[model samples]
Target: EDKLSQEEKQSRANHLMEVQEQISYDLNQEKIGKTFKVLIDKKEGGHFVGRTEFDSVEVDNEVLIDASKFYCRVGDFVQVKISEATEFDLYGEVV
Candidate 1:
């Protein structure tokens, strides 16, 4: 396979970093806008934490299920409600 040039590699890295930063910022803001299918990976005090297939656990985004109204069991593919969203994550309830 052909290797990327230094400039190209840097450019790609920068782009990825920008996307990651955007996602991170969005998650912190809890601005969920779209809906997605998510699995309940684990539970926190008031947060049902999981990751989207498009999102990486540590690098990409997370699916934040509102513990109040979102109904989901671990590994279940349920429709989630996106009340708040961020570039890297979304806060949703089960619909």
Candidate 2:
């Protein structure tokens, strides 16, 4: 049996992490067009940032379509419909 070198092990670990992240992102895509109750934790870059009970994914409060119709502050629970998702975050609108 041959053992992997340190560099090879580190490279394999990094690749695994990337694969896992991609899998997670792919799974998160299923949340699109779904509504969830998200708790606003904070605001970032003029957008509210929050997480839901589902996997604790980041729910971005800024909706590219008609964002002016809703307003929420931190510590608020809002019903948000998942509109778009990235590798690590979810974007939605209040419903």
> What TM-score, computed on C-alpha atoms, does each candidate reach?
0.59, 0.79
Model 1 lDDT on a 0 to 1 scale: 0.72
lDDT of 1 by residue, 46-69 (tens): 788886656556765677787776
Positional deviation of 42 in candidate 1, in angstroms?
Answer: 0.4
Worst 10 residues of 1 by lDDT: 26-35
lDDT of each: 0.72, 0.73
- The per-residue C-alpha lDDT of model 1 at residue 24 equals 73
Candidate 2 lDDT, 37-57, residue by residue in tens: 887777666577778855444
Per-residue error (Å), model 2, residue 14: 1.3
Best by lDDT: 2
The residue ranges of model 2 lying beyond 4 angstroms of the native Cα positions read: 56-69
Q: 21 in model 2: Cα distance from truth in Å? A: 1.5
